[model samples]
Target: MTCPLLKEDLIFNLTQGLGYEERSLALYEEFLTMLEGKELSAEEIHDKEIIERIASDERRHITIAKRLIVIAEEYYHTT
Candidate 1:
């Protein structure tokens, strides 16, 4: 059976360079773990507020990966 999470286009784009789907999957899995453990600080949740350094660091990698998929689909026709 295929893993539903692995089927996402974002996961596909991130893993393309690595050539190992498991690497991307592992990154997102860790991201999910971080998100599950807490509510963001009031300051961190606002669009105009500067995100805390620690919180930004925690989310940056996955956000980059997700952006890659959007870029691919929107500009490169990867999908």
Candidate 2:
């Protein structure tokens, strides 16, 4: 049987990573908004694109983390 404590630890780590990704999403979203119409240097423009990519990646990470947490909870209960 799977260890209950191990499941808890996995869930906790997933939750923590989820939180960080959420925060990243929020920050990037805000940064993207702040980049509106105003002119930007070439580097800043490049950064905006990078931020957009990171934000999208973080969103996916959050989704995966949430799914993993649910799976972990189910296993935790069954074990």
Candidate 3:
């Protein structure tokens, strides 16, 4: 079952989540850009791999957040 949240609460959480996801995506992109044109050190390679994995997770979080927001909207409209 879905936890009940006030309209403002739902919006607040969704806005915060999107902000986090946006920042996370930018940070990951920046990391990738920094390493893109240059040769990667062994350490850099490891960092990049880890970052890539985290970036994927961040993207998933973004999608989930978006879906939740939509659900919240529907819930509010229906009720």
lDDT: which candidate is best? 2
Candidate 3: segments with Cα more than 4 A from true spot: 1-4
Candidate 2 residues 1-79, lDDT tens each? Answer: 5564677678889899999999989999998999998899999999999989999999999999999899889887886
Model 3 residue 50 lDDT score: 93
For each candidate, the alpha-carbon lDDT, in order, equals 0.51, 0.89, 0.88
Query: Which number leads on TM-score?
Result: 3
Between candidates 2 and 3, the TM-score winner: 3
- Please write out the lDDT profile of model 1 over residues 22-72, one tens digit for every residue: 455465456656655577676545522332343455356556656666665
Of 1 and 2, the candidate ahead on TM-score is 2
Indicate the residue-level lDDT of 46 in model 2: 95
List candidate 1 stretches off by more than 4 Å. Answer: 1-56
For residues 7-56, could you state the per-residue lDDT of candidate 3 as single tens digits? 88888889898999989899998988788978888998998999999999
Candidate 1's TM-score: 0.30
TM-score per candidate: 0.30, 0.83, 0.88
Error of 2 at 40 (Å): 2.1
